[model samples]
Target: MARVKRCLGIDLGSHSVKLAEMALDGAGVRIIRMLAETLPVGPDATEEERNNATVNIIKGMMKKNRITTKHVVLCMPGQTVFVRRIRLPRATGSRLHQIILFEARQQIPFPLEKTIVEYQVFDTEKEREVEVLLVAMKRETNEEFMRLVRRIGLQPIGISITSLALFNGQDIQRINFKDISSKSGGGLSGLLGGKKTTKKKSKKDATGEGTSGEGVDAADQEVLADLGGVPAFEEVRAYVNIGARSTDVAVCKPGEGASVGFIRSIPLGGNHVTLAIQKACGLETFTQAETLKIEKTAVLSGSFEFEADKTLYDMDACQAATQICDKLISEVRRSLDYFISQPDGVGVDVVVLSGGSALLGYLAGYVEERIGVPVELSSALGNDQIKCATSYGDEFDYTSFKIAVGLAAQGLGIGRLSVDFLPADVRSMRDFSGQYVEFAALIGFIGAMVFFGSQIGAESEAKYKLTKEKCEGFTQKNTGGIERARLTALESKRSQIESKATVLSDFVTPRDYWLRFLSHVYQSKPARLLLTQVVCQPNYLGVTASGATTGGANSGAPGASSGTALPSSSDPRSGIVWIAGEAEQLNVINTFVSDLEQSKGASPNQRCVVKKATLFRYSSQAEKSEYFAPNPSIKFLIRVEVQDEEGCLLTRLDSQPFMEQTALPAAGAAGMMGGAENGGDPSAMGGDPFQEGRGGGRPRGGPGMGPGR
Candidate 1:
């Protein structure tokens, strides 16, 4: 088994720090531990004080969780990083690096030398243009984060933004859910009831009327148009992560290859709601207001009214929280509107909410009602790829650790974006660490060479001559008359054994040629192409002779057909293979022919087994056979000429008039060459080579030819 790797993803947010320990192996990624610690510093604390608090909290969390993984992936706050999607010409290597660097200089507010810039190129529908997601951060901020990681005895490998991390986390969860659903055949829809599953309607149904004159109302049609009818906004999803001090929004196109199309950060979050509650209730401390908000506040949406027994303080807290939420939702709406107004923008179909504040009661409902889109609370606990240990407790806050999970997923090579913000000095350190073993081995080699050279130089001339003479004397003594005679006898026996083995190999090789031929054909066939018939003939002239047969049980050989005689001087290893198949597309047939022509032996120097592969006959309007009903497909017949490993068939093929004869006539002429009534089964021509103790014996017919009718 391959070695298992462990990585730690740290989310250093304003309110708390989250650390997720992930174990990755061939099986998949598993969450070994997740720990969160709140920062004790107040909002008015200095930067140095906040940094100290963060470092101390992370240290405590690691010690409590017993996490020994040193490699770390850190998530930078979205507000601190600048992210832009730029269009550039398709390039690679140094050219691509230069282009991105130039773009970064123009897009980033900071100077190039003082910023850490990373870009990821995305695939687009355009042929010549590529979309690049460029991210930049101040070098000082990056160094400060790295220093904090080092202070905690961890190695920082990658730095990613919160918005991108949220996108990645949601994407991986959806993929894992789909994979599990496929395997179980239940789709896990009942488990994730928060998500809306929109059923696609046909053109007639989408046009708002049925054949019986029953029609959908204007409101329903408008909703459908908003959801999916627009071409530029199809299948888009938004991931909203509301942290303590800010909210990150990532608009993405979701499908097999999901990508973030737009990203923005709003400076309103749960902290604003806490401050609002504090000011409304006239609380002495912010902590008291936070407690009141968590205990009594619930955002009222729609027609939900306050309870008759509710206190004035409770009402005030709820109203304050609701007002902050309203403002936050409005900001999110503005961001989405701005994105949709762009030329290449896509409308979000659904919003998935995550973060520490997403756990608030009725928040998802409020967001849904305000944003006019379906909302779901993101939970990593139910994801198939993330395995939680029993010690983590059943009440774990899965949503709050989403960014950490996404960062760890990127470290495990599961995320789509491949951006890294490690400085050059760190990269050089990692590279040197990776090659330490190689450097040690090289130093050892030099040391051994030097030691041996010194020893050789220290040896006396007389001693060297004595050692050489002793070795020569021993060789002379060993090669005397009896030894020479014994060596010659051994050589003679080896030669005789080799000659016998050669004869046996030649006899056995032909018996398995049909099996090899069939195996190669099966392996080369494309998934869309289905074979209907296959026939092999030893030589071109023998096809006519085989077709002349009816049921001559006593023709030539014991296994020969009733009215046909086996071709004389036929070599089984060399033959013409005829294949007939049906394909959904013409390209599948062409792909099959190309594979056969390019197929070669295991060794690089060995020649291709197929001398030539030809498309003998093709018909686009071929009738569907009884086996394949309803839909018609393209029918094709291929003629593949194969040669023996020894190339003996090449001489015979060149000497014969094979090329002058068309493949279709020969295929029809040998129609009766592989039939069971002629004492052979077409399927048994390649007798199971995998079966043990099999011999070099033909199956009741001439070598290489199977019975057909």
Candidate 2:
């Protein structure tokens, strides 16, 4: 055998817990250990007691099997999960997830918030439609299993439905398709064609009355074909996994392009037949009836000889057992019929049975007779599929352990329909840890490359220095006054370039400051507030803005009061940032203003002061719908000024260069300030305050300086 890895697969059923440990190599599987423990619940056990009993049973099984690996995969019971197969348009590039969500909303009975949904897409290249298998389970149900599994000191790698896992465990994928003939255009017809069976034209025939040697209806033949077709790379078929309390019906199509057609659970199983026997035979206890049903009943003949002391009683007991088998068979036949009647239905080539109940003598033969198809009992492993570590006793039923084996197959990364329902948090943590390891490895690689490159660069530099020395001697011998004059001109040019570079190094454009200020204002503003413009006001004007007093307005305005402290009145120093905006509610605008005042970026060097916050206008009707809605609402303005930490207006070094060239006349400044208050134009408010200037700014008679100079 090639190198193999061990995986533990666990199946938690209502009455029993099955655990299987398997070592899987390429195309090979070995059963390391397989064990099943009945749940220790008593007849009168409470829910809590039942859970405790289950946990103890599981603990014992793990200890007996000596399963140490934390990498475990669990099979969620089929009855708890909702499975649906849907077909969607074949278009690509569309958001498939959105489409699935929309379909889920329509199909899922419960509210979306209560469930966790997962899906697998079938690869249908060149087909007009795509098939998808969608599975959903209640959040609480999934979390309960996860919590229980965690308590046992195991990490769940994936959680899948038992039916899907069963599909993975079998050798259905390896069956040769060329040997099977599609005579009836049914996938499974060729495999099941030899022993011809026919159905009579009666109600009993329609309701599943044909024996194995009889022919079923033409539709039934096709249905059987669809149920077990293995045409090519992909095969679609139905799987019936019977458990103690429920039977899972899953239609599986396996290959690189395979998908589940449908899956559901019928609440009929071995226990139901046992209950029927208990009721019909007047049995006093359930255990006695169960024993009689398992031991005394034979599905092949539907009758068994009992004790001579009560010959009539034996007949009655035999009749009761037969009735129980008929009921169970009826239920199975109905489930098969339902599968066949569905859209895109397929025929079942053969019925594969595996479960604790499947071991009841002659059950497989009985189902085959009634359904008019081949029925075969499944084994723990297919021929040449797995090698056993220890010889299993003949008394041990390997058929009952198929589910556990399937779960192990899923964990070994060899299961089809390998959809993981692990919670998002666990997946995220795993992905983050994996990425972290990769990142660390990359950093180490880069460090090694840098060290090697530096040594190479040092050696190259030494060679270049020696080559330059040899050229310098030839150049020195050809030197004269023309070269000297040219060198002098080059030195002058270098000095002039250095001076210009120094001046421009610390120069910040007025446009840059405007962008930074506006970004901060918008970022700090509330979502409901709509901003129109930001107007910066000079401190020279002795105006007291609302909610703030800057050095008493005229405190240091060139020739004003004793405490006047407007330091850069003539220069375009720090000024009030007026934000004009509108809101549907007055409080929203107020909140926007408050948020700006509290923002650190708006403060800029801890010199921010909220000057004015007031409603500028109330509009009842609007030219644009966004500005006015319903009743009248206020359009507001808020002004904040940046000052030095020493409580004086400050000028930045970057702004000083531009400020000197854009000094405006007092009358022109007054007109701009008036326009700022009235919300005239955004340009008037703060855009290019030095649009018309002598130099370094737009010229007075430039293209943007109005029609006349």
Q: For model 2, how does the per-residue alpha-carbon lDDT over 1-709 read when each residue is reduced to its tens digit?
A: 0011567888887667888887654334567778888775533357567667777887777777666866677877788887777777643324656677789888899998998988765544334555667788899998887777777667666777888777766543343333332332333232222243343443212222110111233443332333234445333455677787788766654344345556677777777767767777788887777778766755535222222233323445556655666776787677667767876566667777888877766677667878787777875355443457666544456777777777776665445455667788875564464356688999999999999999999999999998999888766865775776798899999999999988876453333444455555667776655665555444533334432224332321222234344345333344555455556665676566567656544344433444334332223222232555554434444446643232323233433322211121111232332233445332433222222331112112101122110
Global lDDT of model 2: 0.57
TM-scores for candidates 1 onward, in order = 0.55, 0.56
Steric collisions counted per model: 10, 19
lDDT of 1 at 140: 90
Best by lDDT: 1
Least lDDT summed over 10 consecutive residues: which range in candidate 1?
207-216
